[model samples]
Target: MKIARIEVDGARRVGVVDGDRVQPLAAHVTVEEVLAATPAERTALVDRAADGAPRPLSDMRLLAPVAPPTLRDHITFEEHLEGSLKLLGRTAPPPEWYEQPVFYFSNTNAVIGPDEPVAVPPGCERLDFELELAAVIGRPGRDLTPEQAGDHIAGYTLFNDWSARDLMAPVIPVGLGPVKGKDFANTLGPWIVTADELAPFRRDDRLALEMHAEVNGVPLPGGGDTSASMAWSFEEIVAYASRGAELRTGDVLASGTCGTGCLLEYWAQAGDAAPPPLRPGDVVTLVVEGIGSVSNRVVAGAEPVPVPKARVGHARRPRPWTST
Candidate 1:
């Protein structure tokens, strides 16, 4: 069953998407609430929700399929990694790069759903977008074997990890990791397609899927086959991630950017061209097969204002740093 969050009449509620209409779930359950429900109970609740008065999908705002997630783990796709390495002047990833999966923690608070507006931060002159597939963890498990990992997934959704290249450049030199460059904003969903529905799509080496992104109305990137490019399987990633840590419900694991998934691969070359990043009034739309599309608008940053100087009588002295 496809699940989504919708806002109708100014109130947010969970719902199941059917055709162009939505069937509201029993009240607006929090992410934790839905995760806590048993699979059988969850299925029954969705069925009952669908029995209610239906609303046109176009009339309501589609929020992220999953509620506020606890964490988002980004897994590297071979195509993206190879392309990125070449862009950085490396011949290929060091042998050890593929020995195990690598990931980074992204801010769950930065997530927004379909058709939402994302703020283009100041000083970030090179904004980019990545088209990816994200897996939602269903059952809780840690140190799970690869054979057991498949049962832990609940569903899948399309993810767009908006990036700021300019902000990322500085941090790379410090070796601190992708902190500021990545945390800006991440987009997910049109719906969370349950694993059972997507079972046929998942494969050992690659998921046979097509992905594409458009800037405004023009197609920017994507036309390649995902099945031919992926380096690892979702099961491997889940198993690796849960080695010692517990994998809980509502945790999102993302397939890192796809090859030619963003302009960073097609338009710009390292140290040569840094095109003007996404600005206010621009829209980015990402489409993945099976899963629906997610579109977001880009808005300008609010101008910074200056603060007035403190009054003379209220001025404070600086504290001494040296210990006597």
Candidate 2:
């Protein structure tokens, strides 16, 4: 079953997308509530909602399926990371990457849904899109084992991690940020496909779904990479993510960019031959077989405001010397 969150007469409502129409659930129903239910209970709720009055999908405005309480993106694909690192003059990832999945938290407030416009961040010239998959957390877990973590997932959805490569460049060397470069926007929606629905596609812990992306009307190079190629499965990534901190329902754990999922990887591979970065009016669409697709149009961003100088310019006060 495909579950969606949509706008209905100025308010948000949860619904199930069936064919080209949507069956609206009770106004009080929410994806979070559904996630909190036991599998049998959740199935019963969807079955009952399916009998409600249906609305054409075209008439409803979809929202990000969940308003994530927290979001973390992980780099799990070796191909994508190997290509991305080339731009930074590295040919291979650090040995530590192979030991474990690494991740970064993103701004949850910036999440948008299908067909929304992605604005070019101020002072950014190399705008790009990352085609990835996100796993939604259904049950809370802390320091879970991979086998246990699998049971905590509610479902999956397509994710677009919009990026500002120009702004990202300077900070990568500083060891701590992708901050201003990435905090502006992220796209997640179309709908969430329940884990059971994707059971047939499961290969071990990773789904064997075919993934593809296109810019404007042209298909991107290496567009048919499969989700099965991920070096670390979502179960492993989620298990690592849950360490120490509790992962609550509605939290999102995104599988970072697939191989050639972003222009940056292509640029790193093609060098000066790569097509230019995204511009206003450009449309980017990503598709994952079984999960569905999400499309967004690029738009111009607001002018950046100037900043004042720092009060203390690296001055260190002298302390009385103590003999060792």
Best-fitting candidate, scored by TM-score: 2
Q: Whole-model lDDT, candidate 2?
A: 0.89
Give the clash count for each candidate: 0, 0
TM-score of 2: 0.95
- Model 1 Cα lDDT, one tens digit per residue, 1-324: 677877867877887777888787666465445544556877776665554698888888888877544655555677677767776678788788778878888889889899888887656777788888888887888998878887888778888899988778767877777777888788988988877777677665446677778788777634644733667677778898898898888788887887768767764344454334577888888888777788999987654355596567875567697455
What lDDT score is found at residue 179 in candidate 1? 71
Task: Please provide TM-scores, in order, for all candidate models, with all chains considered together.
Answer: 0.86, 0.95
User: Per-residue alpha-carbon lDDT of model 2 for 181-282, expressed as tens digits?
Assistant: 898999998898888889999987689889888999788966558889888888888999999999999899999999889898888988863778999999
lDDT of 1 at 298: 91
